[model samples]
Target chain A: MLSPILEFFSSDPKDKKLKKAVEHIIGQKPSNIMLYRLAFMHSSVSKETVAKGYKESNERLEFLGDSVLGMITAEYLFKKFPFKDEGFLTEIRSRMVSRESLNGVARKIGLDKLVEYDGNRRTVLARTSMYGDALEALIGAIYLDKGFQFTRKFIVKSILTQHFDIDTVVSNNPNFKSLVIEWAQREGKQIRFDISEEGAKHNKEFTATIYVDDDSFAVGQGYSKKKAEQTAAMKACEKLEIS
Target chain B: MLSPILEFFSSDPKDKKLKKAVEHIIGQKPSNIMLYRLAFMHSSVSKETVAKGYKESNERLEFLGDSVLGMITAEYLFKKFPFKDEGFLTEIRSRMVSRESLNGVARKIGLDKLVEYDGNRRTVLARTSMYGDALEALIGAIYLDKGFQFTRKFIVKSILTQHFDIDTVVSNNPNFKSLVIEWAQREGKQIRFDISEEGAKHNKEFTATIYVDDDSFAVGQGYSKKKAEQTAAMKACEKLEIS
Candidate 1:
């Protein structure tokens, strides 16, 4: 059933420069061939050519892979940092999976070299974060070809443990929301942000106060109550640091 | 770490009568132990006991498992019904993963008999649907413990291939949102819901209209515009019988 799709990979000969570049980036020989093809398949390529009758582009795989990546990352962070609370875990994962980080990885991996497109000039802007998404789609393919355990190991060994520093990265770039949530949880606190007045109907300003076990910690204002609380909580964290 | 947890499982054992009844229903010995256990762990259980100090609940795992399940089911449906389009593939997947269908599976497996509780019986309703969530959680656990290949095989053999009659099921159950989206995609339709209306400043009512190549297919009303559009889309699907 997948023979035609498999043929697409073998028929398209890899350029020497592209192969070396991919080897340097991926840190391993491309074990599963389908993933490499998927990484290069731009939406610009006619969908009919990619899969026999698959209608949508790699968007669905990207979505699926994004969630898978998230789960594996979350689990990794959870086990790695045993003492870290949910807020900390969430922040770290967010940082790891953020568009900026993924794009950086994509660029580092030189994914831009492998992408197949119709026009060279027009495809310049196409190389941006779409490469990161393509990278994830490739990961999804690897996961399908090789099992999850192998994929998980490959992700950690090849990507995270090899390229990134876990502790320094997390400690230096703390998520404000996570810090506040962790502090609250640690102190057995209950915080609520009540928007007493929104200045305008269309574009409203919200006032939020952080409560630690019903006592007000700090108050802040923002366009949204969530933002306001986050600001308030950040201020409280600062205050606690001083105290 | 798991001894205390295992005690909870051993406390009730499986009610002999219920076991016999389930065996009669399933026509086989339930080989998947972790899956059954996962189907029983309600969110109500203290987070400390589940993963130890981490608030690592089943929610994240459920989210990941849901996507995996969705993709696998879509692939199955796509191959099984070669004549069906993208819309048909999507609707069948939705039907397979719907909360109601999962809940039904939970009932069939007698998962309700295995749940551990602290006996907060008054406010919280302990229904079989919770088992569906646990089922997803268990898949997460299996992915962790066994691997994705095992999980995939378990799902295919135990659930999809054996239990579900795909043709009859898909023909009977049609997902409205999926139908509308597919129809829009195929017809080269551009649809947007104009939600400019603001009611009583704070409160808002949104009206949504479905446009198929600039023609309105249906109109829907709701508290939020996104909701309204979804409702309208659903209505359009019903009217057109797009599924």
Candidate 2:
């Protein structure tokens, strides 16, 4: 049933390599070669195709895959932790799908070898987690090629089960923002965070200052606002002895 | 096959009303009546069941449904606007799934009549978008009960094409943030926004101040930081005359 489609991709050596890599990673022969090709085509390598104000790269696929990943993960956690509340489920899901986690998983699954991008370390794309983004795009490709049910099974059986241990993820979730909020709610204290972005667009940094009961306690900085806020919250938690 | 399930729900008058209402809105009989019932159970009314420090309400389903809605909408927009970039697709999707839009759609579908909640205007839930939240939860219920394809068809056919006009939605999208960012990118200018939250949690408002080249250009306020930023961006656009 699949020999004809397999032969189409195997005709060329380069296509054979992609087909083999994708098949090895996703555990299935890709029906659509174009989608799999596009999934790995990072924006850094496609800067010229900006006629529509956006590069013809994997970004759109990333957006779609991100949502698919979220839904699948949410449902997984929702069912797996039936008695657990939304907060706990959300934390675990976030841990499982964090950029760091995705990048790690993508590298472990050899996606970094398939991802096409500018290799220069100074490039903004190189600095960011393009591998993770590629992984998401690949998932999007799988979804579009094989439909939602197949994608869900692949994600659950292949990605989640193979790559992540729920117990470990739950214990390792570094969500200080959620922690601080929970603490504030318990202590009946007012908590807020003020985030400011600075530096150039390529090297933008976010500084988050956390306040409790209108008093600034700690400040932290990171590449993103969420990370900065988490750092700030972690510091606040430490200061308030909220372990 | 469905008669047995229909008979199961039709036994109770209230359940029958709910069954009829949900069937009317979704254009299908719900197999899982419990999921549909849980979809309309607002947090305000479920505060008593806080064993896990979170109320047993539609929130978890809402979270699940939000991702499902996002993925469906993203795919829909991606396929619909083949020539448009991710930014345009994102803006349109945001417009389509905005709190105001969801609330309007839910009311139009008569979900307001079925949704169970405290009707007191003074309650925070009443002031906020519980209707929109319920709509999302309902989508979650549909996805869980009938699966993704059915939910996607229902959304596209019953909700998107029925309640929303694509052309009008595209033309009327209030995305001043995108406009200002585009202008800044074109003119090689620096533009940034600082958002601050004020007042109590229940009545909190976000004030977004737009800055161009380190100088504050304009400020706007709204219930959400995104809205406030959009308002500020609109004012900045008016002053800069980019449009």
Candidate-wise lDDT, in order: 0.60, 0.79
For candidate 2, the per-residue lDDT at A160 reads 95
Q: Judged by DockQ cut-offs, is candidate 2 incorrect, acceptable, medium or high?
A: acceptable
lDDT of 1: 0.60
Q: Encode model 2's per-residue lDDT on B65-174: one tens digit a residue.
A: 88888888888888887656554676688778988889999888888888887555336556678889999999999999998889999888877888888999888765
TM-score of 2: 0.71
What CAPRI grade goes to candidate 1?
incorrect
Tens digits of per-residue lDDT for model 2 on A164-193?
A: 987887777566788898988986989889
TM-score of 1: 0.57
For candidate 2 chain B, which ten residues in a row score worst on lDDT?
A: B46-55
Candidate 1 at A122: error in angstroms?
3.8
Q: Tell me what fraction of the real C-alpha contacts between chains A and B each candidate also makes.
A: 0.15, 0.52
Listed in order, each prediction's TM-score against the native is 0.57, 0.71
Give me the overall lDDT of model 2.
0.79
